[model samples]
Target: MELALSVLQLAVRILALPVYVLHFLGLWSWICKKWFPHFLSRFTVMYNEQMAGRKRELFSNLQEFAGPSGKLSLLEVGCGTGANFKFYPSGCTVTCVDPNPNFEKFLFKSIAESRHLQFERFVVAAGEDMHQVADGSVDVVVCTLVLCSVESPEQILREVLRVLRPGGAFYFMEHVAADRSTWNYFWQQVLDPVWYLVFDGCNLTRKSWKVLEQAGFSKLKLQHIQAPLSWALVRPHIYGHAVK
Candidate 1:
């Protein structure tokens, strides 16, 4: 019985090898950087429009603090395709930092469409190394769907805390590890290696909130959301604010 199980696991891994090779070899990254943003831009635009209720609810927290005057300074890490641009209050200036340089083009296009916000600059830097953004420079640091894929969640959070002005908020929306009781959690563990390869290093089992807690936030608020599982690997989500 043990032998049979071993063989099955080996087979599963073998079947997933192609994705690993493509991703680690930089081919997948190249493709995603080049064309994936365009596809994601369209999908998010449609998805956000269709799911306006949920999107609005998630963004309302940001709107409350940033206000309508748009005077606040905002820094968005992993500002993919500028999905959050539409939600910013009018006149708020934004500095975007993303590791993938390919995102800059799409982000600029999205900025053009976002009349409420002003673009200060785009820095091609990872969340872990944002030295270009001075400490305590931003009133609000926004991170949506980014921590799960970063190389080190701790370092990223540290940088986040560093850059945030005292009493400034860090708003995040992240898909997190599922509850252990679920079959989906089992699958997430079993398929984690391949999933990371195919999805640009997105870990299916990261306890992102724990990382947030350990980062020493003065205040942390999180809302656990179990969205109807369209994609089993990324169904569990946490959305809220953490103050530094």
Candidate 2:
């Protein structure tokens, strides 16, 4: 009976794939571009609640590079909903970039709420191509939960390196590929295509940390972590800094 049910489910997903593809090509892009960041901004509150301790540590790392003096310039790639706004020190300038232009409104709201961290500008650009930003101009580059969905992780990292000044920091927190023996890993591999179709190209099994290490960062610090068991498929994560 279970085998039959599994087969039925797979057949349904297979049938849905074309529909998803069409939606992505049609109105889905508009919807995602318009409201996805708002959804993420609210979702982040609950997400932070679930991983409060980890978030604290991540923000601490951000502060070390940004510092209290706030003279630093930060360029945040995939700055969805500006969740990191409050964590930044006062006097620092922040430039937010996201492919989803709808995030601009939410980012403005976040900036208003934040006591520190001045808004520099909002750029509508993908992580793979950030030509609007000048090379070696930013003191810190931030990426959180971003690489898994980009068309080319390597290209995005190259862009990160190009934008950051020498000895500048790249702060990141990302969900990544899981251990092969785990049930979550098995399902992640099996469902990746459908998952991407539903979630705007988010991949469940990317080895993001390894990609960052190979990107020629002069210094790297990384630690693996597991999310709450409730979100099993995306449980594995890595968060740290890489200096260019």
Q: Which runs of model 1 end up more than 4 angstroms from their true locations? A: 1-9, 23-29, 46-51, 63-70
**RMSD of candidate 1 to the true fold?**
2.8
Q: Write the per-residue lDDT of candidate 2 for residues 1-244, one digit (tens) a residue.
A: 4575477558758788765777857976676566567668877777767766776777675545653454788999999888877666677789999998778788888888976777889999999999999999998998988999999999999999999988789988899989977777767877776777667779998999889989999999999999764578887999888999
lDDT of 1 at 151: 98
- RMSD list, candidates in order: 2.8, 3.1
Instruction: Specify the highest-lDDT model's number.
Output: 2
Shift of residue 232 alpha carbon in model 2, Å: 1.5
Q: Which stretches in model 2 have alpha-carbon errors above 4 Å?
A: 1-9, 15-18, 63-70
Task: Summarize candidate 1's per-residue lDDT along 123-209 as a digit string, tens digits.
Answer: 999999999999988889999879999999999999999998787889888889999888777777777776676666778899998
